[model samples]
Target: MIWLLLLLSAILGAIAFVAGRRLATRRAVGQSAHSRPGYHGAYAMIWALAPALLVVIVLLVFGGPVKNTMMESGSPAAVSALEPFEREAFLADAERVAAGAEPLQIWEGELAPALRSEGARAHRIESTISGAGVLAVVLLGLLGGLIALSRLRPNLRARNRVEGWIFGLLFACAAVAIITTIGIIASLAWDSFRFFQAVPIAEFLFGTQWSPQIAIRADQVGSSGAFGAVPLFAGTFLIMLIAMAVAAPIGLMSAIYLSEYAGSLTRAVVKPVLEVLAGVPTVVYGFFAALTVGPTLRVAFNDLGALLAGGPLDGIGQYLMLVQNQMALTAGGVMGIMLIPFVSSLSDDILNAVPQSLRDGSYAMGATQSETIARVLMPAALPGVAGALLLAVSRAIGETMIVTMAAGLAANLTLNPLDTVTTVTVQIVTLLTGDQEFDSAKTLSAFGLGLTLFAATLVLNIVAQRIVKAYREQYD
Candidate 1:
């Protein structure tokens, strides 16, 4: 009913606005208001909508807290022991009673009379208050719109006021999105801070070991695992380096080919095909990395060396063995393949956006395509390309599934691509994957890892944005 009323008010207000505009005359009206008749109508429309919307928004923000407070104030012991299912059942029975309907039969059979009666009373009050609030907002919206319309005059600047209001609304809405992000970051930071209090910050940061195991029982264990995070960082960086090595060249080259060399038909077919890679599930990629790519790489390394020395492969086999299993090479290589389209597609857009006039000038100078591209286009598009690479790096750094599946869990401190290492993300996932007590250092450690990851990403993003801005200035 409230929604229906709001709709009616809007329709009526619009009609009245149109009527006023049609009646407006240049000379007949004694004095013109701030804006013309049409703007006045819009002003009325805004006035009509804003109040009710504000009321609804305020109610939504407070509704949960209000309900919780009411429930808490009533008596904690009453509902504290009730299981989730029982509490829900109790609430439903109360609602029916509050509505003046006969109590549910099950309530009479299972619950005590006093408890059921109290619940029913609470439900009735909450429902009545909510219903009345909605009705009031709807009526007020119509009343506000009507009053604003009557006050609308040729001298009034309704259009300016409305535009100001529109901009304010937009700013407010944007602020909400920013505030939400800040809120999430704050929550994670707080959790991480608590974990830091339990575990020394220096050990978490600098210790090469990372064992986030907690004793489950007093009688069961001699010592729990350490929470040194060094290995996780080493593993993540190793894999990222590998991924960047592969993705940077392949993705950038693909972008170059598409933007500068590929024919339209080839581009039409190939671009979409490449993007399909992105749509593939990360889990699928994980399995492919662990099962398919890892083994294949091991075999390929051996074969290449053997091929190079078929008759007398003296040191070939030895070299091949060095690059095998749980190494940075395999994870990086696979991740690069996954990230190729991300880098290429973004790079292509930036490259394509480089002004056509610059290309024309280069061509007029008798410069070859390669020369023009290398000297002029690349310089111009460097910022955008740089931004794309940074974004790709961000993606690589945060990647979880592939590393979790292929990168060995053992956080080896070795920097060699062939040695297995773990990442901060993988450690985080492992730490909190199971049921955990909130206060335990093991679970809280996940938050610390999260805060680190968040900080890294934030820094990278800021750098990327700055680079992109500089690139934009080159054209201007």
Candidate 2:
């Protein structure tokens, strides 16, 4: 019904545009027209569509409450007699029945008849509302179009009016984005403040343990749960460092090769194939990490450890024997594979943007290709490359799905890549999963972690921007 109303409104607007254009053409046939025929047509079209669209918006906003009121007032005795718990469900069932779906709940005797009658009532009420809405849209569209047409003139400035409407629309879009960001910040800050009240900021930031559960009673097994978040912070940093270690050199080298060394044919073939990594879903990477990479590393390490257990490297062998399928190394390696495209694509573009004259000058100076690239091209493109790497770091920090699936959720503070660890994002997801009370420190902790993550990313972005600004100044 809503779509039908929108289509009818559009048709009305189209007809108005045609009528308005013709009238403008007729009126200005002998005089210099102030506005073009197209402008006049658009003016009438806006007028015709505005009122009809407004009707749809109002109906959407208020229709639910109005329909519920009507249903409640006309509800049969059987519905009125239902307990509150069952009443809402039964009412929903009646609505479903009215729409030609079976009632989800069973009813007996007089109640069954009452349910049928209620369904019919619902159908009739819906019909009335839909019919009235359609009529309102058609009438309003025609009335507004007539008003617009009656006022069309050679000097009316229809284009100015339409352009003003466009400016207002663009301003509204900007304001909505600004408002949404402010709202999110405010919500996170408020919830984080609440969490901090329950858990000391120092302990959360510096202490090493991280158990979020709290018991309802003092005698419960885990009443005073540990909340030190140092382990989570350490784990997050370790994984990010390991990921960057794998990604940075490889990604940058690929970008350099793709831009400076690869031929056109090679670039076209290889760049897309490399970028295909970016398109592979992170969940798929998580599966690859967990099912393939993790097990492969564990088995190889365990077998090697067993072979070396009685040798001179026995201590190291014992440690290797403890290597697990779910470890920081597995998660970090997979995440690095995921970040390759981001680094390579951005760095490639930046490297390409460096002046071709610089390369020409280096060659004229008798510098070899390798030296020219190392001494000139790389230095010129450093800021952008740095920015690209920072953005990749931010990407690493925010990743949850791959971390959750690949890295086992144990907030271990140890830095050994073979050990299981979890990041801030994985812990945030763990804390907030399923039914939870916002008042509990456990649940509120998710907001705290979220705020921390946001701040870290925001800082990284600022740094990236500053680096890019420096490069721009150097070049400009």
Candidate 2 residue-wise lDDT, 147-174, digit = tens: 9999999988988998997889899999
TM-score of each: 0.78, 0.94
Q: Tell me model 2's lDDT, rounded to 2 decimals.
A: 0.91
**lDDT, candidate 2, residue 216?**
80
lDDT against the true structure, each candidate:
0.78, 0.91
The candidate maximizing TM-score is 2
Could you say which candidate leads in lDDT? 2
lDDT of 1: 0.78
lDDT of 1 by residue, 1-476 (tens): 34544565566556556644544434227774566667766777777777776666666687667765665456345554578777656666665666677656464333566455666667756776577667767677777776776766666667788799889989999999999999999999999999989889998889877766655776543156578888888888889988999999999999999999999999999999998988888888889888888888778876776666544665765676556556677777889989998999999998999989999999999999999999999898898899889989999999988887777788788788766777888888888787778888878999999999998999998998888777665453
Q: Which stretches of candidate 2 lie over 4 Å from their true place?
A: 215-221, 474-476
